[model samples]
Target chain A: MTGTEADHARHNARMLRIQQARAKMQARRTLERGLLIVHTGNGKGKSSSAFGMAIRSIGWGMKVGIVQYVKGSWETGEKNFFHAYPDLLTFEVMGEGFTWDTQDRARDIAAARAAWERSKELILDPDYDFIILDELNIVLRDDTLPIGEIVDFLKDRPLSKHICITGRNAKPALTELADLITEFGEVKHPFKAGFKAQKGVEY
Target chain B: MTGTEADHARHNARMLRIQQARAKMQARRTLERGLLIVHTGNGKGKSSSAFGMAIRSIGWGMKVGIVQYVKGSWETGEKNFFHAYPDLLTFEVMGEGFTWDTQDRARDIAAARAAWERSKELILDPDYDFIILDELNIVLRDDTLPIGEIVDFLKDRPLSKHICITGRNAKPALTELADLITEFGEVKHPFKAGFKAQKGVEY
Candidate 1:
């Protein structure tokens, strides 16, 4: 309703140029290796995005492993849904709870260590194609886990195993080694509007 | 290994204070309503994260609806996975293709309008609890669809129906009206490192 024939033709020509440039870019991008994807920042959807990737992997019949570092005590919707895919997905909940809930540094450190051990096993395992270290960044941010060892181990993981680490305030070292880093910045939240977290959405 | 008994006691006392404050804050957040979530910016996982929320909603036995505006032509893993839940989901693919691939302004607008019509139906449908409008922002950014009418319709949607709109460059008007807005910013990407999109991970 808004474009003239001349305008349409001009738009078509501009799109043709873009299509050709995209083709050139696609031709140059030939490398295919597993990526270290990091999702961090003070926003929602860090772990949700990882879980979504897990579903996508399961759609293609690829094995997925997940380790929760700081959100294990509560029964979440994602957990219940992922439990349906035992053959294709292995989900390990290893956190005691949120740091505020736990309130014990020693116990938090112990839980982080155990979760990291499990994560390392998943990374080294040949059967899994995708592994999600859900909220691992929280542990790293609090210095509950050793970053150097974790980075070294991740760097040496299987060439075709995609690993996703998620949480707010990801360590700079980890982001430096990541192939993809998506910082989920929160522009607004319901909590600020005097609303509590709802079921099937916030969890 | 990191703290003495006195230090541990001090930490526990500090945490108690924080917990008390948290409880007081929680007491104030009592409102409950559906959320209008927007995922936007130039990064990966905007749509993937919305898909994840759909899975989370499904876990809680909630019905879902999805409309793919610009991604309907491709056989995405998400589309394939979501198709498994025919009983609980209404999946609509109503795009000719990407704008470049279509290169027809009139056709793109028609497809966008058609998709928006379907989206409105889903939003107003009482049976559906969650609805995802995938890549709708692209068409909005291109002015293929009328934003004012769409925004008005969305603002008047059911109070208990959660809606997620995902894509890059989301309209400022939508963000201003949204309950939650997560901007997914890309710090690094595999594509920049000469890596082509993978099967399960990318699609």
Candidate 2:
């Protein structure tokens, strides 16, 4: 079976049009600035995406600083694997645990404040090229730290540094400042099918 | 200004409900089979997600085999950084380049077939725990290889092997067999603003 002559002609025409659109779009894009990116949604890869970006940064010999909020001191595959890049990646896991695990509003707030303190220093420091605020949105959602305050701090951040904020339920105000936003929508998760979140894979 | 008591109560109630739903979901999931995962859509970071998983798998001391279907031999940061894991990670850049660059259908088909041959060997060999097929969807889009060949190959694969296929417009047959599928919806891309794709980040 084969496409008719008309069908083939139409396909070529469609391809040509798409090429033109892409070229037009590409020509207009020339700015190169550090991006404020947000990864949010109910999907499993939000924080994973952030870590992935961190790896990419490290691969390029860029210095990376990471502050983990809400994950606490648990052992994670990313933290362990990225240990290989000590000079390029500085990782700090500061949260006590998830909000549910802590169950204390005051403690959670304090931990967030401490993590944000670290985050502020990382953002301000000139040595780091990329900073990842892992799970900051979760803390923001719990109101442990005011979104406005964080946004205000980011306003004057260095122009060469890229920042990635990952978690679910990001506030609208944060979204406004993000140059790139990706919502990882879940199609099917094996956990719902009774697949335990195994070490290395889920972490 | 502090929230009223009603606001606090509403927040706690919402938190409680979320906790309950999470607990219920956690309880229902008990299966532990290896997954066929697909990362597809117009968004960025699909390949980065796969690389992140590769890092996780490496942390667990698992062997990884990677095949780049359409990304020809440009010096990639991943290739350089992951080179440190020579014993555990095997990275191959097999493509002749993007189809537009090659502009030869037969040449594209041959390059894709060679890559798939490598992919088949990787997936079938017991040495590899995880195999990543980067940009396979693009080759599939151009009919470089038939979808049925891939689906049939995956059918009899090891029960404990995890395979990740990344690219836009994944074939429906592959999606059908995939245990987890994520559509990375692009909210913002720097290229639209005229920023070119950078080495580490875009690769």
DockQ (Cα-based) for each candidate:
0.76, 0.44
Worst 10 residues of 1 chain A by lDDT: A1-10
Name the DockQ score for candidate 1: 0.76
lDDT of 2 by residue, B1-203 (tens): 36755665565566677778778887877877668888888887788878888888887788999999977446777777788888999998898876655545566678899999999999888998889999998888767899989899898888778888989999898888888888888887777666766644665
Candidate 1: CAPRI quality band: medium
The top-ranked prediction according to DockQ is 1
All candidates: TM-score of chain A: 0.95, 0.89
User: Chain B alone, TM-score of each model?
Assistant: 0.94, 0.90
Q: Taking the tens digit of each residue's C-alpha lDDT, what string does model 2 give over A93-198?
A: 8886776655556667788999999999999899998899999998898788999999998887887888999888999999888888888878877776678786
Best-fitting candidate, measured by TM-score? 1
Which residue pairs in model 1 clash with each other?
none
